[model samples]
Target: MTTTQDFPAMSGSLQEPAPFWRRRTGTVVTSAALVAALFGGVTGGVVGALNASGGGVAAVSSPVALNASSTSDVSTIAAKVLPSVVQVNVRSGQGEGLGSGVVLTPDGRILTNNHVVAGAQQVTVTLSDGRTVDAAVLGADASSDLAVVQASGVSGLTPAKFGDSDRVKIGDQVVAIGSPEGLQGTVTSGIVSALDRTVTVPGTSTGRRDSSVSYQAIQTDASINPGNSGGPLVNAAGEVVGINSAIYSPASDGGQAGSVGIGFAIPSDQVQQIVNRLS
Candidate 1:
């Protein structure tokens, strides 16, 4: 029996500027020069956007000299948060898919992307320690692209700490945890490349109401890919600040494809609202 979860307000908007490195230049400059320009501009935009959001540009500090103590570490973070991160598998009569999710409550409430389990006949959640459990839809919001699911007979589930995304600054280190390409419990690290980036996600409905959702995301070069959707983007303090969403892979023929050291994650502040509604 196929079940459909209704995701209200599950879309978002896009706000990154046109990558400047692809522009044409004077006769003297070669194609290589264009590529260099593009790389520089994209990188600069990432940093600039963060600065702009954080108020103003500050002096660049040396990475070596910065040593702020935090309760988050690889072993500690993994042990504490891994059980919360789950593998979401959706199966319909005609198709099947796999994605990532996080346990938001001890009583089986889980958080994931609405699109992940939108039209599944059955949904299964796999834990980090290899426990698979059947899951039911709690509520979904399409405009926000967020969903909440519930599992029965699940115990000892650890919920993740939600961080204030608005307090994040440029150059802040971040960690992404999820199942990329079906590989569960994968972890990647990178800096908060940008913030307040608006991306347009295609709306669920058609016709006049077929508008897009504007999302202010946290941009990073953390190697997020297919199957990583809905995973948590954690801060140095091991708090989740964003949810891994989309990648800007232009077409190869004068376009972009794959990770070119650029990736995006939805801000946790926005996600918290949807999660709260489900709770």
Candidate 2:
């Protein structure tokens, strides 16, 4: 029962909605089961029981101080946006994963990559203020690797301002925030390396039925990793232009992974559609 309040969502979405499976269980059962699986066992029960009676979890409010030449107003942007950013943790029988997400509405609607929360029996979202809350999967589209989750018993949440990803060009600076390698609230900065690039994402049984979707991505040099998926890719203006999705690891080392100064993000225009549908 080691309860990690904040987990990060990674990856991003692509154009054209892909078909996905819907969980049949009611939101209550699914959420309860998720919490139980994570905090009910002997290892988890102690923390779960403690938190269950210890009132609600506190939220993290401190924002990361980002430094970039073009971001002279970085403090204003970070302060305005940090409240909407959240750390997501997904747990299943096998193990747990981490990623990041954006709160889409004041009522606690959040958007993140389907791959980040895929196969998760339970999901918990931690706000920037250190408050931890249970989340429910509203809908997930695996083909696009996008999913929407909602948090309960939380209010006054800030939503991220969306930017035009289509207008983003190569060489523009971008920032990413997520829990890389389980280290929560990590931030990295880089420039858009490429645009409208297409890459193939290996299919998952739990992913969209389309088998694969070609992405119109914003390539960057940001240090994206397993836990950085589903996080926001912000432009120099501090607007969310893309969602951090994947990185290209050279095939040289027998598929051993390494950053080659290349990473990709799902364009924001496409994300609007999904978020609108969820809202």
Q: Rate the local accuracy (lDDT) of all candidates.
A: 0.53, 0.54
Please identify model 2 stretches exceeding 4 Å from their true place: 1-76, 205-210, 252-258
Question: Could you tell me how far off, in angstroms, the CA of residue 208 lies in candidate 1 after the best superposition?
Answer: 16
TM-score of 2: 0.71
lDDT of residue 224 for candidate 1: 56
lDDT tens digits by residue: candidate 1, 1-279: 212221122111121211112123311121110111111111111111121122110000001000133435555655656667887776543244566787788877888766556555677888878888999878877677677889878887888788877777767776567765566887766677777655544332211122344466666766654566667877656678887765544322222223444566777888887788875
Where does model 1 exceed 4 Å of error? Answer: 1-72, 205-211, 253-257
Instruction: Give the 10-residue window scoring lowest on summed lDDT in candidate 1.
Output: 57-66
Candidate number achieving the greatest TM-score relative to the actual structure: 2
Candidate 2 residue lDDT tens string, 163-184? 8777776667666676554456
lDDT against true structure, model 2? 0.54
Clashes (N, CA, C under 3 Å) per candidate: 31, 30
RMSD of each: 13.1, 13.8
Give the Å error, residue 229, model 2: 0.5
